[model samples]
Target: MKIFEMLIPMTWEGLKVTMSVFAITLIVSLPLAIFVALLKGSKNKYIYKFTSAYIYVMRGTPLLLQLMFIFFGFHYIPVIGYAFTRYQAIYIAFILNYTAYFTEIIRGGINTIDIGQFEATKVLGMSKSFAFTRIILPQVMKNIIPSLGNEIITLVKDTSLVYILGVTDILKAAKSVSNTYSTFTPYIFVAFVYLGIIAIMTNILSSIESKFDYYR
Candidate 1:
């Protein structure tokens, strides 16, 4: 078979895996990020300590090691061993990793809101929680959209890391196709697929930024 023929099929297969992981990560991470950001910003000492340690551990570790730990390490445990599949393990690892990163981003957005705004909301008879939801978070969302978009684009490329757990993601698909055909054209095809997805993401993010331009 010609190299281009092998490239197309390989690229298609890999793109599926990459998109699946990327989608799942974004869905799971967004809410988790808000929760963690709140915890990290809380005044309670225990909450601060626990969330700080969690973020440190996640950020400090290599993502590949984290995936391997989740995929392989849990099997040695008592009951959960038989329950986790490679796909589930990979999903958990990606979600947790991205959640930590996004939490920091979100916390930055929250911090950018002035304390004066919160005080003014309180003076206006708004409860703290109500003020956060109605007044503060909306503006934070505007600030965060661009940074979050960057993370989403990065996730598209990082999905290739799933191959560490034997997941057949796009880069792995390219490798398989290359090995089958004994050529490098499969990688070129895979790169094009990545470029196309990233291009689409850029357009979507740019649209979002324009829509939220009042914050700027």
Candidate 2:
């Protein structure tokens, strides 16, 4: 087989890892974001204070630092004793980082709904939770889709950071292939892989936006 044909399976394998991270991040982060948004929006001072500090620490620090800290830092802990593997560490790090960002986006989305809407919901005998599900969340998601698209694209590229913990994702696969072939072809192919993933995501998000435009 030609070198390009050989690259097909390796590149496909790497792409799977990258997509897995993206899927896991979204699945875990979306609901966590809603809870975090509620915490930040709560009337209780302690709840708000705790969430504020949590967001502050998460946003103020670098994701790479957080990842390294958990991945390697856990190894030094007396109890856990290196039970977590690199892929697990990377997944956890990305999930935490994405959840924080998603919370902010959701908060903004929720705020975009006019207070009059809530008042109207109350007048119509809707409970806060019911109104949020029936009216608020739909509108919030519409507003947040653009931001979500950006975050998802960033996640695609950010999976490369997994290499720091020795996870052989698409970018790392490219490196391995490059080292073996002594050429830049592998890296070029990996770029296309990333590009393809982003392009497909962009199209999917764009379609969602278009479908939701009627609600705007």
User: Residue by residue across 1-216, what tens digits does model 1's lDDT show?
Assistant: 577676677677767888889998999999999899999988999999999998999999988999998888888878766546888988999999999999999999999999999889978999878888788877898999978988889888889898887878888988987898788877887788789889999998889788877766
Q: Lowest summed lDDT over 10 consecutive residues: which window, candidate 1?
A: 1-10
Which residue pairs in candidate 1 collide?
A: 14-170
Q: Model 1 residue 65 lDDT?
A: 95
- Highest TM-score: give the candidate number: 2
Output the TM-score of candidate 2. Answer: 0.93
Model 2 scores worst on lDDT over the 10 consecutive residues at 1-10
TM-score of each: 0.92, 0.93
What's the lDDT for candidate 2? 0.87
